[model samples]
Target: MASSGQFAIVTGASTGIGLELARCCADEGFDLLIAADEPEIERAAASLRADGAKVEAVQADLSTSEGVEKLYAAAKGRPVDALLANAGRGLGHAFLDQDLADIRRLINTNVMGTVELIHKVGNQMRSRNAGRILITGSIAGFTPGSFQAVYNASKSFLNSFSFALREELKDTKITVTCLMPGATETDFFRRADMMDTKVGTEKKDDAGDVARQGFQAMMDGESDVVTGMKNKLQTTIANVMPAETLAKQHRKMAEPGTAKD
Candidate 1:
């Protein structure tokens, strides 16, 4: 049986890499506080409980300040030993055609939501002078995205934020690691309405593999890591290649009208 003392909070834990990450944490014997926006959260939590890990499930729309606040309320006063601020959404379509409300929600959840939770929980961790944080980033942040413009931009913010955050917390023992994954097989593609695109259709890394790589990296205290060799090469090319070239390549894969219909 898993001990109930140490705890890790993971947002977006209903499915995909988040679900896998929660499971991985459970395997390592950490009790969990997992949140997701959907009703399936209860089901997911129930399964975790069955596995003998003490679990708390919170269903809140992470795209709003209220939602973030609620999750914080559930976690406040508990000495969170680790945090996985992984809740996020994806947007598809041309920038102009995108709905303003959806764009705002993406910004709220992907950037603001994560930031607020980190601030709340991170402060606690900092005060204790002990904790670990694993923020989920993506290869999408490495370059300009065509159809996934806003989604990519949000990730860019997260990537940059994580880097700066690591530096800010450098003197503290509270390690922050950013996990940048590329095209993983998850509900993210369908949820983002990108199932027809290259990233949504191509063979991709399994969520379990990506989660384990991220978990190990977080425990090892690596500041940032891309999950696969191919992805690492892509990040390398993205760094050295001209923006115009990279953007063009990205458009071929991400632009809804540019790729095959």
Candidate 2:
């Protein structure tokens, strides 16, 4: 059985869905370790603290090894009852037009950072014999993106990693969940400079609702949870459609000059 002091670490908890997830966990009376690259992390920490959650805020870039190491060090000696590996960003425009540094950061944060954090915390959870992990994957992973190519590919890797890791730890008490959401209202699009794109400005689902679904599914030990009916339908269509067709459909939404929506 887990103790009352058990901790839940949520990366990217400064805003958007990650912030909502942190609030959700705190509402359930769990201590929190919230990480973000922004100064807003302190504001989030303060809010959670005021709400009676014992919160620790760490402002570190999750796109680098040093940043991830900082978070791991902060979590040492604490029993991680739950972990939300939710830190991520998106990119827009032609892949060739993007700066090499930006591309590297996207890959590092979405792929390498997630993999390393999961590997470490996952082992600790297994050792403790009880834990739950919720990874943020995107609906874009199901199809090949044109302008947003690298971001989608990174999410595809995350989707695969979460599912495979879940199977590998099936005998243990630790639970792993992958959350797949599509076109949620978030700073992601704005940050990616993709607000003009269809996926960015089109009518979107709320981040809070999406986070709630994932949080509930994590508690239930579900392997994967797709939020919103439209998103579910999209996932279903992606499963049945040919890769070439899906990629073509995505180009209209993701390509810079196209505006099919």
Candidate 3:
């Protein structure tokens, strides 16, 4: 992709797809403002800087207004050319087996925090009427995640919300693109406590590849882009498959200990 000397903000950049997405932005010649809840975000920033990219990393808990404000403040009134709202949380196992606190945190980070940041930055994009927004949704949103209910639901919300937002901005230059990736090689499965499950243990797509696909789609202003061919076929089947059947299939992959079962 050709380089653009612009500004962008990518959240959840400490590791995984978020970090790769930030790299794509830098490669495209965009000055970056990246954030994550972990201190590793600073390290990610340093590495990007080593490559001659101008990056500002913020360690903020984006599940609250304060964190959202901190990120928005970092831009200091400069217009953002792109907003990669990629911060999200995941949880595995039965809903009943999970603590409500963890569940709440997951929901807040995935849904609330993401929406808050978008509402703030999206308005600025609107005023300028030229910006690209890439949201990291999941192919898990296509089905009912039996053991991973909340996380899937949050992604479904994002998938739906992206379409609505895109339509709302259809008359403008602002484009909202949802990047729906299936399982990818990332710390997400471990962080979600699903290492014992089949999907967690199975081979998955590369995070860098996924990020490149997403970034390209966003630059082209596509409505949505699912990362892999297998995932694309799966989602196609999901459209025709009954919800209960999809849920059952999801259970087989996401249920704890299913890898050995």
Candidate 4:
């Protein structure tokens, strides 16, 4: 049973910032439909339900159009109040050394599938002229990630796309807010095989705090947010720094075997 007719959808909600984002929605008394590629999504649903929110979990791979459709179908045409497109994968290595298949999947999951789902749900929101969208971009988008080339490129696409979409929909009640976070305490570094890199091993922001800030920004209809002072500074500098300089700076942080003791 839903505590409220209002509902929110969060992708990649099995863990990390995604799960925390779902929690934020639930805390706001919204029903939730959360998805992830892993079976752990069920556990995430259970946890939310324990807190009194009506929650549904769909274990769908969000890297393909078919998977995106599966999630969309689960909504059963309900007017979603909010859509948090947070599913994405990261890769860390020299661009040439990365496997082609991994690169393709990253692009598909981060870029293609996200836009596909947004297109479907966004049209629904536009029809009603009421809704919100929170895209999980990253500070990584602002920099040229040398060892993490493809992943950063994907974030960059999202950052640009979100702003453009927000401008296009400015006349509507629907709001599109991009959540650009810095590195956080998530499994992202481990999954990206970046444990040996300096950036991977460095201290990171808390996932819960990041998600809370993002959710609030979405509710407030803010155009975008960069979570921390350090990251804010990074973005400001990135705007002025030369591309080659940014790339080299990224290399120092992301290059393998660079982790400090």
State the lDDT of candidate 4 residue by residue for 1-261, as single tens digits: 336678899998999999999999998989999999999999999998998889989999889988999999999989999999999999998999999999999999999999999999999999999999999999999989999999999999999999999999999999999999999999999999999999999999999999999999999999999999999999999999999999999999999999999
User: Could you tell me every candidate's TM-score relative to the true structure?
Assistant: 0.96, 0.96, 0.98, 0.98
lDDT, candidate 1, 82-176, per-residue tens: 89988999988788998999899999999999999899899999889999999999988999887788999899999999999999999999999
TM-score, cand. 4 vs. native: 0.98
Candidate 1 local lDDT, residue 130? 93
Q: Give me candidate 2's TM-score against the actual structure.
A: 0.96
Evaluate all candidate structures by whole-model CA lDDT and list the values in order.
0.89, 0.90, 0.95, 0.95
Task: List where candidate 1 sits over 4 angstroms from the true fold.
Answer: 257-261
The worst-scoring run of ten residues by lDDT in candidate 1 lies at 252-261
Give per-model CA RMSD. Answer: 1.4, 2.2, 1.4, 1.1
Extract clashing residue pairs from model 2: none
Worst ten-residue run, lDDT, model 4?
1-10
> Candidate 2 — worst ten consecutive residues by lDDT sum?
252-261
Best by TM-score: 4
Where does candidate 3 stray beyond 4 Å? 1-3
Worst 10 residues of 3 by lDDT: 1-10
Off by over 4 Å in 2: 1-3, 257-261
Q: What is the per-residue lDDT of model 3 for residues 1-261, given as tens digits with 9 covering 90 to 100?
A: 334779999999999999999999999999999999999999999999988899998999998889989999989999999999999999999999999999999999999999999999999999989999999999989999999999999999999999999999999999999999999999999999999999999999999999999999999999999989999999999999999999999999999888854
